[model samples]
Target chain A: MFAEVLTIGDELLTGHTVDSNSAFIASKLTEQGYWVRRITTVGDDVEEIKAVVGEILARKPEVLVISGGLGPTHDDVTMLAVAEALGRKLVLCEKCLERIKAFYEKLYSEGYIDDPSLNEGRKKMAYLPEGAEPLENTGGAAPGAFIEHKGVKIFVLPGMPREMKAMLEKEVLPRLGRRKFLQRKFLAEITDESKLAPILREALERFNVRIHSSPKGFGKYIGLIIFAEDEGELEKTVEYLESRGIRLEEA
Target chain B: MFAEVLTIGDELLTGHTVDSNSAFIASKLTEQGYWVRRITTVGDDVEEIKAVVGEILARKPEVLVISGGLGPTHDDVTMLAVAEALGRKLVLCEKCLERIKAFYEKLYSEGYIDDPSLNEGRKKMAYLPEGAEPLENTGGAAPGAFIEHKGVKIFVLPGMPREMKAMLEKEVLPRLGRRKFLQRKFLAEITDESKLAPILREALERFNVRIHSSPKGFGKYIGLIIFAEDEGELEKTVEYLESRGIRLEEA
Candidate 1:
């Protein structure tokens, strides 16, 4: 299945934070056989977030993974933007309210907080898009979300790396089907890629392999490396190129 | 002025490579007073690249910095996608060809390459979008590009971090103007953000300062931070909050 990742935060856009989140999520999705088509990062502006959300949702990829903007702070607006894009209302989820209350009460008992009463900032965390199921968060205060809006399966994740990983593994992956991809890397001792241009083109048309050649320096020749569907297909590709006199040494 | 970054690569989309190029560019742009609005990554597929380019260009940010997919490999279609997005044709530029020739000849003289003749793979680097001015590459064969298309100043940089940084510093920065942002972080001993919500909201409305509150765990409180346009404004913010009985320790 094709997928897309949308991460929201001004820190990422301004270079205050590195987006290790997208890479981590995309890799996990790739391991599950999903082709992540895009990873987009936008700031915390409501209009910008809503515009990007609407644009991405319209494309309608099978899997849509969203991270960040799911907190009690002023800038945390991903949930609100998603709800606006889906034309849904922001309503307080009862389960989430209970969870937030319990979390705070437990903290109060442990001398973590001065009081157990819910404040506007903390209470706001419980307000999710209507009909959205709260994805449990064992490591953080804001609960994640899993909602299928307009037939698009979305996994709303927190920006904190620890919480995002936990929610995706324990809550999201178990519900999705899996896929696989076969890939191989090769290096050759040839000086010119033009010498094997025709062979590389032929391999692409013949075996349907997605060809990617990394030519280092001026005269180095290519050993057309490919990502095929299976080991048999990759072997067939190697044989086809070798038959064309393009001997490749695996790197 | 506002800006955006578009990074092109299949390796990045599939999580085979972590994209640090956008952050580098974004941080540099931020230092120059440009507010980077977004950073988007797409695969090597020409259609995908073209589509994203079109979408980004339509928004028409003041500055657009693109990195990656500028090499001679089969997957390097970023230049072609950009040309199509601007409704331009791919044409060979004499300067780039000369640079490529000189680059290869140097490699040949240094015993790096078997021959100095331009191969099809190497020749492809010269065929940029028509009328594009080639940026000097001190670290590689592929030259970057700086073109003003549809009123947006676009810099098409190489995927290699070394070459991208050199071109941006030497060729791009000197011609552009710079802006500045003033920021301050604070640590507080308060447990509830609701205690300071009214004052923080007032600072946002009274001044243009963007306030962000970070709340950690149950008993701990928010560390209110402010991003102002000048040091004086930041100082005013610190005084304003402290005067309201909201004690903040500068971090």
Candidate 2:
């Protein structure tokens, strides 16, 4: 199945931060046998997030993993925007509120902050789109949300890499089931680049593998990635290419 | 003015490569005073690229910078897709073809490749949309394209960072004019995270500066970025935040 990744933050748009979150999510989704079709990034504006989320839903990807904009700040409005996009209301999760309270209290005890109380901005983290399951965040204060709408599994994650990774490993991967897609990287040596194209096209026609090739440099080698469901299929594709006078080396 | 960035590559979607090109483009565009509203990454499929390009145009952004898929491979179809998106035809750019031939000859002379003659895949890089200006790629073989369609300054760039950066600096930024936006970073030392929201909100309302803040850690500091047109506006906003008892340090 195909999936999409959405990352939200004003800092991302302004070029203050490089968006490694979407790449991490895409890699994990790929490992789980999902084809990540697109990755979208938007600013912190509610309207922008809403418009993008709606558009993604209209495309109907099987899974959507959104990261960023879930924090105790004014511009962290991803939850509200996501709720609006799903035609759902923002509702408070008391359990999430309690967890947030304990999180801050532990931080205060460790002398990280002055206050342990939940203010309006902090309490805002407890609200999730109605009917969404609260995904636990082991590394941060804001709890993530998981919702299944219109056959699409939507996951809302935090901006921080540590928190997002924890939630994705603990919460997201488990829900995606046990299927896996194997991807192998290779450097294909071919002196004439034009002749390589027809061979690649033939490989696609004769095999059940997806091949993606890009020139490594202005050289004789092209980077090739073959994705297959099993090792035998991957091996057969490699053998077929090698028999066609293409030298392949693991990369 | 507002802008959008679209990066095309299958490797990006597969997470085999992280997209640092968009961030570099965003930072450069921001410095030129364009609010980058969105960054979209799609695979090397022509239809997907066309769909995303159409969507970005419908938003009416003043500038659109698309990177990647400008190579001489079968999947490098960004220029063709972009031409289709704008309802234009892909016509041969004679100058670009000459440059491509020269580039291959140079590569052959340097012993980088076995053959210097142009092939079908290499020839494809010389085509551009009808009425579009070809941007020189000093670091690669495929030349970029610059098109102005319905008030949008659309720039198609190569995926290679060196080539894209050189083309962007020499070709894209000059066309975007000289309007510059200044951005300053600070670490705002605030003990209570929630209390800093209203102060930031007030800073935005009272000044022409745009403020973005995110927690540095579960600690007493928050990362802040202030964007403005001049040094005076930026200084005034920083001073205003200080007056509200928020400690600021250059970061």
Q: State which candidate has the highest TM-score.
A: 2
Q: Model 2: runs farther than 4 Å from truth?
A: A192-194, A229-236, B229-236
Model 1, stretches more than 4 Å misplaced? A106-116, A184-198, A215-225, A229-232, A245-251, B180-198, B213-225, B229-234, B245-251
**Candidate 2 docking category?**
medium
Clashing pairs in 2: none
How many Å off is the CA of A197 in candidate 2? 1.6
Per-candidate interface DockQ score: 0.55, 0.74
Worst-scoring 10-residue span by lDDT in model 2 chain B: B211-220
Model 2 chain A worst lDDT window (10 residues)? A191-200
State how far residue A82 of model 1 sits from its true place (Å).
Answer: 0.6
Residues A1-251 of candidate 1: C-alpha lDDT, one tens digit per residue: 58899998887887767898899888888778787899999987788888988898889888899999787666778888888878889998888989988987887788877878887767888988888888998877788888897778888899888889999899988867866666667876577654565567778888866776756545565544477667787889888888887768887
| Index of the highest-lDDT prediction | 2
In model 2, the fraction of reference contacts reproduced equals 0.77
